[model samples]
Target chain A: MGKKTFIILAFQISLFNFFVTAQSLPEVKAHQKLMVEEEEKEEYEFARESKNEVEMVFSGLFLGYKKFISSQDGNTCVFTPSCSEYALMSIKKHGIILGTANAFDRLTRCNGLSPEKYRKDPESTLMIDKLE
Target chain B: MNIVKEKLSVFFILIFSLLGATKGHTQDLHQTFAFANELIESEQYERALLTFHRVLFFGKGSYQEEIFHQMGTCYYELQDFENAARYYDLAYFAEKNDSIKIELTFKKTSSLLLNKDYGYAQIELFNLPDNLNPYFSQKRNFYEGITYFGLGNFTESEKKFLRALPSGNAEEKEEIKQIFKNLEKVEKISPKKARILSMFIPGLGQVYAGDWRNGLNSFLLNAGFAVLAVQTAFQYSIWDVAISILPWYQRYHMGGYMGAERIAYEKIEREKGLIYSEILEVISETKTD
Candidate 1:
C-alpha cells in the first residue's frame, strides 16, 4: 500500500511536469501580449501609387489647356457633365485641389481602400517545423 | 509535547509543498503567456489571437485584461480595425484597475475611429469624461475632431480641434494648427452643378470634375451610339435606331449624367478622406514619438 501510494504521487508529479512543459511550447498561443512587426508593403501597391502620380500630373495639364466644343446631337454622352468636363470645370472653379482630387478619384473609381482584401496575414515560423 | 511538535512540523511541510506547487503553477502560466507572446513575435497573428483568447477562457490567471488587450493589438497589427475595436472594447471593460482604464479607453476610441464608426467614437469620446483627465481629454478631443472631420461635419470638427490646441505641447500645437489650416482649405463640390452640366453633355460632367479619361470615354461611347442611330436609321429605318442605337445611347447618356453628379460628390469625399488620412498619420506618428 505504501509503495502504491508513492507510485501514485510520482505519477502525479510527472503529469504536472508534462503540463508545464506543454504550456511553454511555441505552438501554444495564449493571450498574445507583444507587438508583431509589420512586413514590407507589396510591390504592386507601390507601383500603383507611382502610376497614379503620373496620371495626376498629365490629367491636370490636359484638362487645364482646352475647353470642349459644342456637339450637334442631343447629349450623346451618358455622364451629364462627363469625367473630362468635371475635371476641367472643377479645376477652373476650385483650382488644382479639386482638380487633382477629382482626377485621383477617377483613377481609382469605385475601388475604395479595401482593407479586408489587403490585410496582412501572419507568417508561419520556421523555428519548429511540424512536418507531416 | 514531542507529538504536538511533530504534527506542527508536518503541517508546515504541507504548507510549503502547497506553496511550491502554487509557484510551479504560476511559472507554467508565465510560460504559457511567453508562448503566446512568441506567437506574436513569429507573426502568426491568427493563432496568437486564438491563444490569447484561450488563456482568457480557461486560464484562471490574473492577466485577463492583458490577454484581451494583446488580442486587440494583434487585430490592430493585422489592420483589422473592426476586430481591433471589438477586442479593445473587451479589454476596456474587463480591466479592473482605474489607472489602466485611461489607456484602454484611448485605445478603444482610436480603434473605433479607424473602424470608421465615427458616430460610436464620438459617443465613446464623450463617455471618457473630459472633466477628469486633462491629458487624455486633450488627446480625446483631437481625435473627436478627426471623427467629425471624417463625418464631414467640418465646422464642429474644427471647434473640437481648436479646443485641443491651447493645451498641447508646442510641436503638437503646431501640428494641430496645420491640420486646422488644411481643414479650412477643404472645399465642397456641389452635386447640383455636376448634374446640370452632365445634362447638356454626357461626359462633360466628368471632364469638369477632372476625370478626363472617363470623360473622354463617356463622350466617345455616347457619340458612338449617336453615330449608330444616325447611320442605322439611314441604312434600314428609324426603327433600326431602337434596336441598334437608341438603347445603348439611352443607357450611357443616363449613366453619364447620373455618374457626373455622383462622381463629383465622390471627389469631395475622397479629398476629405485624403486630408483626414494625412492628419491621422501626423497625429499617430506623434503618438509613437
Candidate 2:
C-alpha cells in the first residue's frame, strides 16, 4: 500500500509539472515604447568666442545693438530670420564685407512689394527669404 | 492505514479534476481567436493585436503561423510597414506549406515596397525560387518591375513589367509597350537650358519654364537693384554703388537662375510621376478586365 501511494503521488506531481509548463505564458512585447531619436536644433545661444579682432568687435556691437536698441524696436522685420539676426548670421558665415551687402539686400527684400515671390512661413506668416 | 489510504484517494481525485479544468481552459483558445477575429472585422486593430498576441502567449503553438500572419495584417492595417514586414517574415519562415510561403513572401515584399525600401524589396524578390507557379510568378515579376522603377532603372523596369503581362494578350502587351516607348520620348524641359536663359536675362528662364509670376518678381528685384546702383553712383559716388548695390544685384541674379533650374527639374519629375500613375492605372484596368 505504501509503494502504491508513492507511485500515485509521483505521477500526480509529474502531471502538475506538465500543466504548469503549459500554463506559463511569455510577456507580450510593448510596441508603444518605440525609441525615436530626433535631432533638434537649439535656436538660441549667447555667443561663440570670436577668434579674430574684427569678428570680436562685430559680435560685441551686434550683441549691444540687440540688447539696447533692437529689443525696443519690436518684431517688425518681414523675413522669418529678421533683419538684424540675418545680419549676424550672414556676417558669421561670410565675413563682414559680403555679409553687410547680404544684410542690406535682405532689408530691401523685406519691403513686402512682391508677396508672390516668397513662400509664407507657416509659423510666422512672414516671407521666408533666408540667407542663401 | 485506512485514514491514509482515504486521504491519498481524495488527493488523486482532486488532481484529476484540476487536470480536466486545465484541459477545458486550453480548449477556449479557439473561442479567444474567434473574438480576436471579430475585433479585426470591426477594424479595431489595436485591440485585435493585443488579443491575438494574448492568444499567441497562452496557446501552445497550435496556429503559430496564422497568428503571426494575423499580427502582420494588423500592423499593415495600422500603416506600420516596418513591423508588418517583420511579422510577415516570421510567418513566412514558420509556415510549412509552399503555397502559403509564397503568399507570405509576396506580402512581406509588398510591405517593404510600400515603405519605399525598394532595394530590400528587390533582394527579397530575388531570393524567391524561379518559376514556382504561374500566378505567383506574375506577381513576383510585377513587384520586381515596381522595385526597379522606384530605383530609377527604367530599362530593367520595362523588361520586368512586360514579362508580368499575359503572353496570350497581344493587344494589351502592345499597349503597354507603346506606353514605355512614349515615356522615353517624354518632353522634359532642360534645367541647364532654363538656368542659361535666366543668366542671359533675369526671370526669362522662369517665364520659359511656365512660372511667369516668379520670373516677373525676379526681373523687378534685379531692376530695382540696378536702378539703386545707378542712383547711388550719381548721387554719392561709384564707390558707394560698388559697396552697397553690386552685391545685392549679384545675389538676386544667381538666385534667379538657380530657382529657374529647380522649377524646371520639379516640373519634369511631376510629369514622370503622372505618366507612371497612368501606366499603373492601365495595368490595373487590364487585370480587372
Candidate 3:
C-alpha cells in the first residue's frame, strides 16, 4: 500500500481500538450498601428493678409463685411467653392496676380454644403470644 | 525411498520432543502472570488468587505492585472487601508511578467503603494529594462525599457531592441537591401521638400508624370486653363485675395503647427504610465521572 493510505489505515485502527477500550471500561455505579444503623437488642433479665413498692411486692410474689406453685404445676401453658411471665411483664410495664387486669385477660385467652388467633412459635408448639 | 521415510520420521519426532521440552521448562513469571490473568478472565477468582500468591511467593520484586493489584482484584471479585482493601493498600505503597498510586488508593478506599468502614475510607481519601488530574480529583470528591454520607454528616456530604460534579453540569448538580432536600421530608410516625390516640379511643393509634388489621382487632376486643362488663354488672353483683369483667376491660384497654405506640415506632422505621432506598436509587441514577 502507498504511504498515505497506510497512515490513514493506521489512524483508523487506533481510533477503533480507543473506542473499543472505552466501551469495555466498567461503568461507574453507586454502592448499594445499606446505611441503616443497627440497634442493639437488650437481653431480658428477671428481677429487674421496679418503679414502686407495689411493683416490687408483686414481682416478689410472682417469683415465689413461679418457684413454688407454677414450677410444680409443670409447663402446662400453651402460650410461648407463659402465663406467669406475661403477668409479670404486663405489671412491670403498665403498673399493678392494668398489669393485674392484663394477667386475668391472658388467663381467659389461654384455654386453647381459638388456636387460629395466634401464630405457632417456630421453636416449639406453643402459640406465639407476648405482651403488646 | 524407505530409508528417506525413516529419516524424515526421526527429524519430525526430534522437533516435536524439543518443542514439548521447551514448553515444559518455560514456566516463567510472565507466563504465570498470564495464566493467573486468564483464570481471572474466566471468573475463577479463587484459583487466580492462589496463582497470584504463587507468583508472589516465587518471583522476584519485578511484579510486586502488579501482583498486589491482581490479588486485590481477586479478593474484590470474591467479595472479601477487608482483604481487598489490605492488598490494595499494599499495591498503593508498592507502586512508584503517581497515577497508578492514585488509582490504587481509590481502589483501597472503595473496598473500605464497600465494607462500611467509612472512617477508614475517609482517612484513605484524605491521604491523597490535593493536586491531582481533574478526573481523579472529581473521583476523590465523590468518594469523600460517599464516606461522609455513610458517617451521617449530610452537610459535609452535600458540599463534597456538589464539588464532585463538573462546574458546568448544572442539571446533575440540581438533581443531587433535590435528593438532599427530599431527605428532610421523609415520612415518620410519631409514637407519642399514636399512644395518645389509642388512650382516647381503642386502636386509633394503630390505625394512625397504618396497621388497620391490628387496629380493628383491638377495637373489637375492647368493645367486646366492655359489653361483657356491662352484661355482668346487670346480671350479677357489682363485686362480681369488679372481680372478673373490670380486669379484662382494663387489660385490653392498656394493651391496646401500648401496642399502638410500638406499631407507630415500627411504622416510622419502615418509612425511614423506604426513604433510604429512594435516596440510594437517586444516587445510583446520578452520573459520575
lDDT per model vs. reference:
0.62, 0.74, 0.76
- Could you give candidate 3's per-residue lDDT for residues A6-124 as a string of tens digits? 99988765454222211011323335435543444333365457778977887788776654334223246899888888998998888879999999999999889999989998888
- Against the native chain B, each candidate's TM-score is 0.76, 0.83, 0.68
> What digit string (tens of lDDT, one per residue) describes model 2 on residues B6-113?
999999999999999898887788888999999989999999999898898888787788899999999988989999999999999889999899888888887887
Superposition error at B117 for model 3 (Å): 1.9
Q: Write the per-residue lDDT of candidate 1 for residues A1-132, one digit (tens) a residue.
A: 699998998876544422222112121121111111232322322112223454556454543332222221233322323444455445544556866687556445423344343323244211121111
Candidate 2 fnat reads 0.00
State the weakest 10-residue window (summed lDDT) of model 2 chain B.
Answer: B280-289
Candidate 2: what lDDT? 0.74
Runs in model 2 deviating more than 4 A are A1-132, B1-25, B60-62, B185-188, B287-289
- Give the CA lDDT, 0 to 100, for residue B158 in model 1: 69
Candidate 1, superposed: residue stretches over 4 Å from native: A1-132, B1-26, B37-47, B166-187, B234-236, B281-289
Better of 2 and 3 by DockQ: 3
Which is the winner by lDDT between candidate 1 and candidate 3?
3
Clash count per candidate: 43, 0, 0
Report the CAPRI category for model 1: incorrect
Task: Show pairs that collide, candidate 2.
Answer: none
Q: Kindly report the TM-score of the first chain in candidate 2.
A: 0.60
Ranking 2 against 3 by TM-score, winner: 2
